[model samples]
Target: MEVVIGLLAVLVLFFAAGYFIRKNIYREVDRLEARKIEIMNRSLADEMARVKELKMTGQAEELFEKWRQEWDEIITSQLPEVEELLFDAEDHADKYRFKKSKEVLKHIERMLDAAEQNIEQIIEEIYELVTSEERNSSEIEEVREKFKKAKKTLLAHSHTFGNAHAKLETALYEVYEALKLFESETESGNYLAAREILTKQTAVLEQLCAQIEVIPALLSDCQTVIPNQLSEIKDGYEEMASQGYFLGHIQIQSETERISGSLSLFQEKISLLETEGIHESLQEIHESIETMYDLLEKEVHAHHYVLAETLKTESALQELHAEKLISKEETDAVKLSYHLSEEETSRLRHIDKQISSLQKRYTHIQDKMANEKIAYSLLKDELIELEKQMSDVKAEHAEYREMLHALRKEELTAREQLSEARTLLSEAARLVSKSNIPGLPAVYTELLSDAKRSVSQVSEKLNELPLDMVAVNVLLEDAVSASAKVREQTEDMIEQVYYVEKIIQYGNRFRSRDENLSRELSEAEKLFRHYEYESSLKKAATAIETVEPGSFEKIGSLVEEDLEELKNK
Candidate 1:
């Protein structure tokens, strides 16, 4: 019983010590939790003060909001959790405090990192908004400049920026409506309709930007700066659109909603801007528009001058080409004429001279025929007396022929001589027939035929008549006289035939001349119509000179003078 009392007393003492140790550990945990809460509250207060300061100083509101939200998350949501962890660590101080502290510190670090990220996001957003706003304003100025340059007068109703702005606002409204429709379509699970609406919105926005470009103040407002800025915006928008950022994707939709809200706020602010300053702003826009107009007008005038110069040069070149063609035509005509053989040309000229001589002879003969007064009775008496003398001579020749026949056996040599004389007459007649006589009054062929007939008749008459040597000699003399008469007639016929041939050849020559002159004249006229006046005149002169030298000199001189005048003009 004494051992049991001793063991029981020892157990009681151990229980008391354990109870105090548990109580002390709970108290220490509670204290640490309170201290952690105090630290968290202090950090929250500091963060809140920073946000308030930023708001009061008109710092970026987005930045201030982001910082405030971070402070709330730390103080309201994470601070209590951190306090619980600290209390748990105190209860296990020998083993848990070090590891638990590390965990708590890690949580705190994460919160701080989140806060920094929020601040950074806010700053980036502010920077982007400010840069975009500046670029948009510059584009507006460029549009104003383009408007001024495109029209003649800023005061003109068609040239006014007010009209352009109205059109731009209408387009913007259309885009807004399209975007709203796209949202509605996406919400209703109509992806195709949503895509179509988005496409339409994009097109409308593009049109708005294009129209803004026409307004000089918006497109090139600052001649040196704004175009580049507008280019960047256009490029950025294109890039974003290409990446499907403007469609109703989750992230893009959220961003677009935020931008739309911001745009609404901006519109409200613009509406509240003083109405009294609007007239001055419009006046400035008008001035920019006028400057743009002047530049465009100058460009137009310069273009007109350049076009006129080009036309003048073309006209001159055409004239020169026409002149060259005319010159070529003239050369061809001359070459054609040169192709005529010299022998043929000379023959034609000789024929012409012969015809002139024959014409003179014919005129002489005609004049003689007209002037002569002849007595036909006296010519008949002379013919009768000559016939009686011829009859007596014939009787004497017949007696001589009979005497020669009686002495034929001894007079063979005399008969042969007589035959030889007869043969000489026949040869003379043939020579006369072959002779080329000019200016004969009868046809050569008819005269030769008549002479042959006379010879045949005389040969028959001689055969019938008997004659001695003396009578035969007399007959031969008469035959010689008759042959001379036939020869004279043949000569006259040859002259007449020659005259006819000469006249025909002369006529042919003149016809050729007329044809050549006519052809040359036709060619000259063609050249003139083609505006080759100088070359045409040269050909005309050459043609006239060929027919009648110095005849076309006056016309050629006039044409040359006119050409000089044209040059001066």
Candidate 2:
């Protein structure tokens, strides 16, 4: 019981020590956390001051607000956990203090990172705003005016709105900037800068002028379709006038004025169309106007009147086709008569007969040539097969000869070994007999006796050798004679094969000549049938030259002479 009381007292002291230690650790952690909060607040305030100084607005302001809210959330949610960790670490007297300090340093680093990001965002926003303000102050008014004018004009003309407005706005902005820069330069007394600005302003004005000039061209293209509905006779004069399609040099100004006059008239006619009720004719007019408008748009884009004028002229030409210059039946009759002229018909009949004859001859020659080719090919194949068979036979004979030679060499070697063995045995027996040693090994003595016996047995075996050696000699002689005979047969067979090959080669050459000659003869006959006497004679001569039998003979003789010369060498 005394020991138990003593243990309880020790536990109470331990509990008191733990309580004091935890309290001190908590106080330290709280202090560190307060310091961390102070640093974070100061960092955030610095960033906010920078943003305010930069005067961030629009999307930038929204982003900054979001960043601030995020910062608040992180501090609120994560700070408690950090404080608890610090408190827990303070109780441990290990490396926990260094570790907790490092954690706090990490939080400091994150805060710094957030501050840097905020500052960078503010700087970008400030830069953008400055640039936008500079641009707005200089060019916004002129650009707005141009955009408004373009929009109104496009709407009035029933033209495309978006693209024209965009173009106009862009051009006007450029002009506005140029003029504003000029004014600014003048106020600053910088003549060179003013001159540069003026040059750029001139270019912008020219571009705008060019764009405006296209408008009337666009209207002109729209007016061209008005002439399509008129009769060909009525439209033709106007079309030619518009296109300067007259025979001679006319004043371009006068032509232009005349075309403009016609266009005015056509416009007046089209204006009448608007007042007409919505009948089929009105629908047609609407479609035509739309088409003309599209053409005009294209013409404006291309900056050319040729395409629009060409379209108008083509429409006028289509209208002129209403008058039948020639009846369909008369045209058909004329075409038939043209095709069937009497002289042409006779010539055609003659050509047909000649062609039929030539075709028959060609087919006959082709068939004959084909047969000759087949026969030659067959002979060539036979020659190849025969050569292959001869090669196989020669290879087999060579293998057999090699085997016989090896067997003969083996037999000779065996005879030599037997003779040497006998000589060695004789020497061994003499040596044993002359030895003076009395107590010699019995094994040595028996060895001497065995050597002598072996010599005697070998001699007896040699004496009793079979007559196969004589038979071998006879067989060898017979084999040599047979090989000679085979050689002669092979030579004869080779000569026969070569002769057959030569025949096939000659036949091929002959068939080739025959085919060429037949073609020439057919050509000559065709020319003769056509009454082309000179050409017919030339073709006949060519045929004769191509197939000359003397040529083949000469070639054959030359080949034979070369073969003989090779043999002699």
Candidate 3:
């Protein structure tokens, strides 16, 4: 009886377990299908938004068709197959085949997963297809408005517009035609093609508008402003010429004729409403007028400059001429000693020639003023030009005279330098003699020889005919340099010899304390005997320092005192 009751309890537990298992399996299937339906709904909404935004319904239709195929497969194949399998699994579970039911549920889950993946991928592909086709509606309208503005400018300035702007007219007509074509294309959903056409047309229309707007200004300038400027330039030329400006270099007649020709051509072009290169020609004409005015103003300035400079030049030339008449003899003798350079010689000849020519011109002008009633207006420039030449000649003469003065000054300087150099040479030799001769380097002898040779060379330069004072000065510098070297070497040798003697004398004190000190002192003495005062001083000082540590400095101070006393003596 206990065994029977236990079996009944086991059957009730098994039935409850089966019922719970079947319910969980159905719930899992429902959950997977709900997830797929949710994804499909969200993806469809996304596709719809993409289609509306991009106006790319072609790809949206393809995606929707593929989705429909997938969905139909899911409903017909996956759903029904899974449902039939679930029934078989249910039958197996009813017969206690829970394993088969689980396997069937797994199969349903896999199909649902694959279907969800395919739907997600299809959604992405449709999204990719339509993503970049973002449409802007006003692109063509913007270009059309630009064309209209350009056309408005053309119509408003139709009368003043250059008749030869047929290209502009053709462009306008083309714009109009293209606008119609754009409208048609736009209504037909060809926005991209219409946008491209509108972009190119807008650029063309903008360029045409720019050209059209400048037409009236160009016409008015060429017709009135530049012509008035030409008149002003002509009057300026005549006015300046009346003021005695030498307009000889300025081809007034030819330029006036050229201006007339340009004006006539411009009038003909204006009559024809010519446009090609018209603005360039207008600017060229304007520049020509300005250039003419510039040239006329320059002439006016030159005329005034000549008038003012003429009086200055005449007065200066007269003063210089008088001075030259007086100083001629004085300068001639001064000039005889001068060694002029090539440039100076040529300048002198030029000055003389210019002075003679100017005087001749002055005399001729004075004669013309006396007899032919020559206007001072004309003679002013010519006479001023001659006077200018004379003034330059006088200035050139002054430069040449200054050059002569420089040479004489150089000669005097050379003499003074030579004397100074001789004194240095004597002092250098005396100083060397006072030093220990055997202790001197051979280089000192060579330096003394160089000094003597330099002094002799400078003295010879002083005796030369042209007296190349510059050469004498150069030799004096060399002598001073050489003498200075001899002086330095001799002085340095004397100082070292004295220092060596003091060090050696001081080193003797330490020689009794150390055998090496005695040996070092002997070696220093041998070097001193050989006239190597610098090395001897070093060795002796080192030897002394080895014994007394600061003995060399004390010795140097004592030797300096002794040398100072000798100098006082």
Indicate whether candidate 1 or candidate 3 has the larger TM-score. 3
Q: Encode model 1's per-residue lDDT on 44-84: one tens digit a residue.
A: 34434433432232233444566567656766766666665
Candidate 2 has an lDDT of 0.46
lDDT of each: 0.46, 0.46, 0.68
After superposition, the stretches of candidate 3 with alpha carbons farther than 4 Å from their true spots are 1-338, 371-375, 433-439
TM-score, every prediction: 0.19, 0.22, 0.44
Using lDDT as the measure, which candidate wins? 3
Model 2 lDDT per residue over 166-199, tens place: 4555556667677777666544434344555665
Alpha-carbon runs more than 4 Å astray in model 2 = 1-99, 144-216, 225-349, 352-569
Best by TM-score: 3
Candidate 2 residue 12 Cα shift, in angstroms, is 33
* Ranking of predictions according to TM-score: 3, 2, 1
For model 1 the local lDDT of residue 521 reads 63
